[model samples]
Target: MHQPLDIKDKSSDKNSIKVEAFRKHVRTTKPHKHNNYFELIFLSQGHGTHAIDQEKIDIQPPMVFGIGKEQIHYWDMDAEPEGYVMIFRSDFIMNSHDKALLELANELFSHSHILLSKDESITQFFSLLAKELKELTVSPYVVEGLLKALFGKILQMALHIKPTQDKSKNLYQQLVDLLIENKEYDRKVENYAELLNTTPQNLNAICRKIENLTASEVIAAHIVKEAKRLLAHSNSSISEIAFHLNFKDSSHFVKYFKRHAQVTPGAFRSSSLIEKRN
Candidate 1:
């Protein structure tokens, strides 16, 4: 199982955030997921396909993509990409007292992507942020303020194209939340539908309408995600992991993993170890 890519601040400051030019650091084309921090990418120059949560989005320059924590994604770039990638933890924004900014951060993550027309001011914001990052003497408070301003700008752009609230979205989110919370013990779509006080058909329809996946697919995806995490990060044996996830047996677990991941559990673990070594 491929472990999610967890990028962390190596700086001495425990609550540190990171900002860097995109082209200088990103080299891989492999698909992966982030474990903790939210990622905000400003694409000033690039052409590629961004796969986020199983949706393929064509990368258009002068657009921004905000990825929430624990989301799976990858980039397939046709050319060298150039932009700024800002990664910060939720606590970075939570430190601020600005209620509106906090709400915008939540909204940005919920949406996952935004399209912005060519704007010099947005480009300038990233440039200034890069400069601040380079200055060793810049105070943490100043950096926090810059982050808030950047989020504020993103919020403004996001609001312009925000869609009206709908029942499908609400139902989908509720189902996803329940699946995530109970993935360890519950894998049945019917159980989730019952917990949400809806029929299996209704749940499936809402999931299909909102995420292009059936309710069973959504539940399995969450379970597979957790399984991958354990396979990559833990020292548990295959049988132990199977029992932990409430599988009937190790053979059944292996069959399920191969059906979904297209690789045996041991092979996945080996590949993940190789990637980590590199």
Candidate 2:
């Protein structure tokens, strides 16, 4: 069975940092990305294609990959793949701090919609942070003190990463920002290309080059993801989700879900709830 992408949709205040770390062995392969949290992966062991957007970058052990919310990236897991992941809300970091980090946070991982911070010093800091994080799972109240230190340490390390290449990413980022604002609208790729003052073929080519999927596919994925969220997190029925998504009817939405997700809306919700219980 395919698991939904690892998306942390939990809430946290600006003053508090909520974090969790775990090790998992890969039993299957899938494409997934976070929609609500920033992710830092300490790849302790494993090898896989870190497919960011549409571009597949080779990932090796002992490297940390940082992914931001709205960044569509995933790992096609291989055997014995284990890692430490620390995810916190972006509110945990401030804009002044963002100015401090500058390109480090932005370039950590990049494709079209996202860029990850990959500075050597920041990577090392997280290696140490991951060790400390493992301690919190056992010791408990250590969370508050350590969380502050971790954020500061990250800011410190951000100083070392160089500025990133902006020309390649700017256009795609605009498209994704537009996506965040207008998921309810059925905006075509041609529409985006025209808005960007480029040809449909050029926009499609760039999207595929950076994200491994077409612009249309990315929008459809968001629709499916939102549908799943409403299905699992709310009391809204299938018809409501379909209608809310502007589908003609429930049948249309059902077929749409099955084509990409390989599971009925009801079945997906039931399985997600079961996972929560376990």
Candidate 3:
């Protein structure tokens, strides 16, 4: 039988932010999930492929990989890797009270992999960020400022490399950001509309215009995607996963998952395990 998925809790009780140089090793890792934190991996050097969920991305140098809070990913490296890994939990961004920064972070994490140019400034930013975090006398404000600059520079580079359809912040973009930022597991359009301070009808219109899906459909897609990730990547029991997603109970979640995924949660998990084993 295949082993249970490895769920890593990298967050410490005290600090919500951390930075460190990437471990140098030539390896393949089992499919695993991280708990309650987003990781940004900046690799100035590396080779092989990174599997994020169902997509396999080639690892090229000078690239930034954003692993979302609940994504299932694994590394398959043919050569020794050299880089830095930056981790920050949701609370670090949410509690900052900077909506723009929070949205920017949400956008950054939305993309699984972003190719970057070989700019010395990017390396310098990471170097300075690591130094600030390592210094015992460094103030929290200094660390936060450095982080802001680093993320801003990365985002700018990502946009320059590949621009999205609409660069302006619209209602649809705000809704997308709110869905990711708010971890309430609320799949209701009315609740999201309330949070967005708009009517459900208006929200639905915007979603249809942007994604060709209704507002309720969009919310359900987000919840179902997260549910699938947990089922496939975490060792959490069905009941535990249900509670984590704020479902009324396991039965309700099972029905929801079956309806959307067209497979029972247990069967899905079993299949995921089988695939990994092969």
TM-scores for all candidates?
A: 0.59, 0.49, 0.76
Off by over 4 Å in 1: 1-15, 24-28, 163-278
lDDT (10s digit) by residue, model 2, range 1-278: 22244554544553223444435754343445566566766555666667554355666554556666655565666656654567765544433233323234444534222223444543455566556555535433344345444444444444344445555455776565566556565647887777778887777777787678887887677678667766655567788788878899999999999988899998998886795476
Sort the predicted structures by lDDT, highest score first: 3, 1, 2
Please, what are the lDDT tens digits per residue for candidate 1 over residues 78-195?
Answer: 7678888888766676676765455556556666678775557777788888888778687776776676677667656653566334546656766755654563668787888888
Please give, for residues 125-220, the per-residue lDDT of candidate 3 as tens digits.
888888887777777678777777777788777635533334323567667657767778878889888987989998888788767889988888
Best by TM-score: 3
lDDT of each: 0.71, 0.59, 0.79
Candidate 3 worst ten-residue window by lDDT:
161-170
Q: Model 2 compared with the native: what TM-score?
A: 0.49
After superposition, candidate 2 runs with Cα above 4 Å error: 1-106, 109-166
Cα displacement (angstroms), candidate 3, residue 122, comes to 1.2
